[model samples]
Target: MTTTGLLGAALLAGLNVLPVQAAAAPSLPRDGGPAAEVLARQEVLDRLADEITRVPEHERSLVAGYAGHTVDPRHGHLDLYWHGRLPDHVTKVLAAAPTGVTAAVHEASYTLRELRAGRDRLVGAVVRGEAGAVWTSAGPLVDGSALAVGYTPDGGGRHGVATAGEVSARAAAVAGVPVTAVTAAASTAASTRHSDASPWSAGAELTTPGNGWCTSGFGGWRGTTAVLLTASHCGTSGTYRTGAGAVVGTATDSDTGLDTTVIDVNGTPSGKYFDGGWDNGSGYAKRVVGAGRNNVGDLVCASGAMSGIHCSLRITATDVAAEVNGQWRTDLDTATRTDDSTVAVAKGDSGGPVVASVNGGADMQARGIISAGTGNPVVCGSVAAPTTCWDSLRFVPIAPIVSKFGLSLA
Candidate 1:
């Protein structure tokens, strides 16, 4: 696939297209025909994206089930993907694609929608304890045709047959989907980030009005009002207080179905995002210039009271679904170690800042916040002093949260 095709797939899979300034075409002469051509193509691509959003939910699902699409900005053509030869009806739909946007179809495996559905089924099974001893999450391959189920062996050195088998069966039941089991370690459960918290600042520890502990996300403002963002699971309403025992805000709105909320704070929340959380003596201060969208392969670092700043974690997947508080949550992004190292996201890190480094870490763009993980404890240290750790971390992208609440980052 061409670069444009790759970008199209990334957007389809819930990734943000890089800003125009980040694209390589900028190196080309602006007055040259190539530059003008690229800009025009970008405009058309933007229209196509808007059209996609306008598609009704029912029709959108059918389109997803039928195939995926990518636009070759250079050629101004849209390429559709499918497991086999493009079906007749799908081809017709492509032929009628938005004017100025040419269309073609390429054969692939299962559609992205199918893969997401399969993942949901498998996760739901585990949440209901139908998956037994397997407590990790699963996802679809890049082509969106197959599922990868993750698990760790039980204390008996065995991944129970019934549990693993059930997960596979559920995924396989999804038409044209296959399951691949992976022996991955599980992460630890959510825990408070710090025993000592600071004034209401991004990445500082705070207790939900209900007394549930969590880290605050990036602060925002609406004219004279100050707003605080945090994980929805933290609590919907109550007086949120700083670790220093000062009341900072009131939880006014929360969407428990999703992992985000907004608090009405009395004072202006700081625009500074803790680079290395208070725990990391190496951490410094960085101002959040703007909010950023996430994509697979992006290098992101997160800050929390427990873990401070852990960087070099590569985002592996978007559109992740997991069971949270007896409900299945979807549209989550995941980060994993790019190399074998001790860096991991842990409890009390929830609702903390996840940012993409810029200028080699001197500045940063706020990305998202820690939500949940595999819930499997990563054991480190010698046999005599085993220490529990976190494996992988999942976060809800901040773009959606900001859009949902109609707020701007401070």
Candidate 2:
């Protein structure tokens, strides 16, 4: 397998693939309509869906019949796709779901493993420059229906003669699956500035020695040594400092494929991250209790030095591949603002934390770290320096990073 292929395989088998079970029942609203009920039902359904998909290491074959799943938080049900017979464990979980939660089983034409293999084939073809220079990115659709291939009208600046339909057909031939061509938008790293004190917290601004700025992500331990996480694209090797010029840490290692870097801290590393606006001066901090994977329709929030906290974003896709900063990054996920008029992410938010509310919104479950901004650009009005925000964003899920680096949450 190629390097990208190997990385993708490792990510699929990483710790994040296993879902965490929710410890408590959801707190439904005191008085509301079906919309409110649907929202409340999501909390427990998310956990139950994860339980149904969990596979023991020795029982990896259990996933052979599994295709993909969609958590419809707005519709108050879980959709599971399968081919052939359902796994024994999956059947049990579905039967024991909470009273109010519903599980809808649908027969699928292809399994997730099969779809992933198809995706890898297409990506490998693109990498070798044999699949035409038209595709910017590609991944398996969450619906288990086809491969979602990204292409622009000008064929991503290489194959202008190719139409979207032609590109889709060509890609489908290579992937051995149905293909859905979507408009490809350009993406840029979100790195900029913020200021904070010692015991450096996540979401604070880090000045990369001569390489501009980026935000601090989750804090964890690399073996016995304390470390901070950030975007590898910010500066692979450098003495990172706070916006106040306080020495934060030094980048000791990084995974370019994952766009994550580990910094050996110079001072204390806090488990909390800033949650207020860009100019809030580190007054608000939220605890990071644990890490989890995001599913389609799940709600998540992002905090960046440039854009603060925006929690209305919904997960739109998972396990995607995208080209960012002239490099192909695999296993990326995309999310969009539920409210179209609001900004989801902006420049300088790269390496910041992407989290979901937990413990009644008092704490957060780490989902991923900000990677790049996609879709249309919006004006960033909070900062004096000119920067751009996007209605949608891409992130690198935190579970694989923690598992790959052998790190533990602090």
Candidate 3:
């Protein structure tokens, strides 16, 4: 594939041109002092968290009493909250923490299961329109403190309720736990861009049938069929192509609630994905070893065809429910850039691969796909249709998508 359009030129200007080396670590912002320390701590925490959460559910008894967990990268501490005795498996995981990392367990008022039950109740109430328009999103806090409900203060005008206080009260009653209401910004899908090569790989730009564009996600298999993954909001039914006009695939299945879609590829898709800094058209491919869950404080990276690769982002929340394009998308995770000066995600980046470093950054583990974003609107050097970017991002976790679609990583 070749890059010859205006979008290609813009991408070349916006990103740092780097040599594609398969063994090179991903390009992340270089920082010193407190920021550097935080990044270092986050990396160690990420590995430990992965080990702790990777235990199979059937054999993991800790999950029942697991309330939540938080990583204070600034202090190099990982705190696990539980409602009762810490399970032996978790204890073992914590004991194995590498030097310089501190792990501790704390008692919590409720278990994750209980908190999720309450969150589900609140979500159901909102879905049934029983909460009015006051509530926009709801999820449990990472500290197992309370159910956080994102609400619009003036949303109750359409319903009988009036005021943020009333909204919080109603939500708390329904959730059966304490509730914290936060003002939230509306979410928009990050779709629009151009740039992709043949032998299609994740992070390549895909042109939708409507002439719009989105980033292709990881390649996977749906039973015996090879498929490509991308954001469902991109287009539920249509053919997708590369920037050079090579056919990529056609939509085979989609779940709008999760904002995920599977495309029947024209040819077998590769298990590798583009990595490193934006390559000015020449991109590096990194093998995807497997898939993993997203956890708070874990650092991850995103690769968008329009904006290129961005790293040093820390996951702040998980299982977030946000309204995107007028529909409620639950089980979403949100991450924010540690370096505020750079964009974490950009328009036309929708459906791009969001991956966590694995095997010491030698490979990547599929974590999620870019869904929507808000905050810090800035020019994205790409002349792509949507020439903007955001500092924060919301992504659809890969676990549910793989489970619901019966997909296995390619």
lDDT of 3 by residue, 29-56 (tens): 2221123444455556766776776642
Evaluated at residue 54, the lDDT of candidate 3 is: 64
Best by lDDT: 2
lDDT of 3: 0.72
The number of residue pairs in model 3 that clash at the backbone is 1
Candidate 2 — which residues are off by over 4 angstroms? 1-40, 55-62
lDDT of 2 by residue, 188-258 (tens): 78873356766767888888866577899999888888899999889889799887788888999999989
In model 1, the runs with Cα more than 4 Å from the true position are: 1-107, 121-136, 151-166, 174-176, 183-189, 192-200, 210-212, 222-224, 280-283, 339-341, 379-388
> Candidate 1, TM-score vs. the true structure?
0.66
User: Judged by TM-score relative to the true structure, which candidate is superior, 1 or 2?
Assistant: 2
Report the C-alpha displacement of residue 279, candidate 1, in angstroms. 3.2
lDDT of 1 by residue, 1-410 (tens): 32223224433333223333322332221111123344344345434533543342122325644434444544555454565444455444443454445544455567767777777777666656652435365666544447776665461243454356664655466423788766554433344333323334577777776675678888887556788888877777788876656777888887765588788887786687665434533324577778655544455677765555666566676666655544556667778754344445656667888886433344567888788755345652211112234657888777667766888888
Error of 2 at 251 (Å): 0.2
- Roughly what TM-score does model 2 have, to 2 decimal places? 0.87
lDDT winner between 2 and 3, please give it: 2
Candidate 1: Cα lDDT at 138? 68
Model 3 residue runs over 4 Å out of place are 1-44, 50-62, 72-76, 131-133, 156-163, 192-195, 276-279, 375-386
